[model samples]
Target: MVCGLLRPDAGSVHVTGRPVSTAAGPAKQLIGFVPQDVALYPDLSVRENLRFFGRLYRLPRRRLERRVDEVLDLVDLASRADDRVESLSGGMRRRLNIGAGLVHSPTLLVLDEPTVGVDPQSRHAILESVTRFGEEGMAVLYTTHYMEEAERLCDRVGIIDRGRLIAEGGPRELVQLVAERDRVRLTAVGDLSAYAEACRRLPRVEGVARGGDRGDVVELVVKDARSLLPDLLDLAHQQAVGIRSVEIDEPDLEAVFLHLTGTALRE
Candidate 1:
């Protein structure tokens, strides 16, 4: 809305109680956005990129240089400050992008999939930086498809699907919606679909899902797995299923997603 890129047809977007459509300078100055794609001039060095963004905010010359150095150090890219954007690796470039966003010290930082394709090292660094910003009391609206990342980074997560927010809560609270006390996974041979149907009818079983190829592996959520094991095996046997291996897994976010959506998160 600030750049005339996205506009609300009916509703409105407000920043700091001021409407974003009309409040460009003041509202825009208070918010920093880090897009999913890296947006840096390939020809410019990291320091030069940060300086250019700082000048856009009309930062004082002396203070702007200090802020640039501070942000570079914050992202652990101070050593590579003079390196051209084209020469840096994917992770380094992502860090520079984050650094550029923080140059103006905005109160709110909106990060859109900031760690989409970076290596584990870079991803870890970016997450750490965001955590640090939160610790410093910066309000952040981070959006991503990775549930684990959201669980790890956000204090409260808003789960959006098809442009609608389906669920919003603390990670633990969301996981509790699945009604899963524990999970039991069985690897077997035979008619799994029939066996899964039988498990679904069981009083102890809360949910059932096919795991791997041939539907050989099946995971079940139940109230008490220890007491239900014998009955489950008996059901499999009744269906002419041969159990090869069995393992119990604890419930996590994936189970919650499955329970709420009736589909596996991986799918």
Candidate 2:
């Protein structure tokens, strides 16, 4: 929708105070979209790519050159302006893709998984660019399956599943929605399913999930984990479960995702 390639089926998309469906050109001009795949012409040089995209937006030659330089500097790709896209590293190509999007000075930037398969260093660089965009007052609609990325980059987040938004709030606010204040993980042996079912029936246990081979490991979310550990152990003992180890994990976005969907985010 932001790129004018797709239209909403029912709802509306707004860009810079103008409705997108009605004011396609003006509204689209305010948006810059960087998709998961790099869209640069591999045959073109970095500067050539920027100049081509800039001209498409009808920016004046002088303004386009200046804007290209500014964005190149912003993305730290100024030194590679004359280099062909294929000559650059994966990280550099990703940076160039980001730089190309900003050449027209769009008010809104939509990045969809910009760091999908880059090296760690390149991924870090891309994240920094996004942070800088927000710092520079650019409204960015960034979408990713990576929870840590969302936690690091977004002031607010909207979690979508199956084409519908399931949760929308600050990270801290969403984590608070789960009733469990704390979580405890236990690795035990012998019929863990029975132990898990028993734990689920316990009063303080808010949720219980079985994992590991033969369901030997279980994660329990509870209102008061520290106090409930004793009762949890007792319940396991009654089922003849042999406790091997125990660990407590802090509640985080993964927990929030699990609580909302009744399945782990990875699943």
Candidate 3:
């Protein structure tokens, strides 16, 4: 909608004070869209692909050449500029995908899961490039299902679930808005029902229930799981709950997502 591909059913979208409903408006020129899947020509060289996109924006030959080189360097694909898209590694191709959007240096860069299906090394590189974009004062609308990425990259996050804007705030603000607590999972050999019931009676534990397959684990939502660990362990020993392993999950964007959406983020 922000890119003006689909018209809004009601209301209006304005980019930099210009309405998006008008085709060929000033708003359209200020946007650089990066799709979820790669949209570059496999047969074309990296530099060629960037030039093609730059030409679509009607950039002058001299300016286009410089911009192509600049974006190639920006995405750290300058060394592979002459290589064909098909010949490049998955991460390098993803890098070029990002560079293609940057050819015209649009004021607003719209990235739709630009890091999907890339290696860890490439994902790290892509994230660094995105960080630099914010540092350089480029307005970015990054969309992703990865809660950690949103938490790390965005200054302000707007969580959309089932087509509704359920919440919007900085990471800390959003997490606090949900009022979720830490989760502790204990995998044990003994009966979990009695353990769960006993855990529920604990002062720090807000909720307790059976978790994991085979009903051998207990999940506890606590005010501060780490601080209450010693008491929890002592209680487990007293109750004859043979704990095999324990996991502490801190409250984060995932918890906030679950709170607002009534489901997991991936769901």
Best by lDDT: 3
Q: Which stretches of candidate 1 lie over 4 Å from their true place?
A: 1-4, 22-25, 179-247
Candidate 3 C-alpha lDDT tens digits along 166-245: 88999999888645488677899776777778878888676566656576777666777788999889988988888899
Tell me which residue pairs clash in candidate 2.
Answer: none
TM-score of each: 0.78, 0.81, 0.80
lDDT accuracy of residue 126 in candidate 2: 90
Error of 2 at 136 (Å): 1.1
lDDT of each: 0.82, 0.83, 0.84
Error of 1 at 129 (Å): 1.2
The 10 consecutive residues of candidate 2 with the worst lDDT sum are 258-267
Question: In model 1, where is the ten-residue run with the lowest total lDDT?
Answer: 258-267
Output the TM-score of candidate 3. Answer: 0.80
What lDDT score goes with residue 236 in model 1? 83
Cα distance off (Å), candidate 2, residue 167: 1.5
Best by TM-score: 2
Predicted candidate 2 versus true structure: per-residue lDDT over 35-62, tens digit per residue? 8899999999999999998888889999
Better of 1 and 3 by TM-score: 3
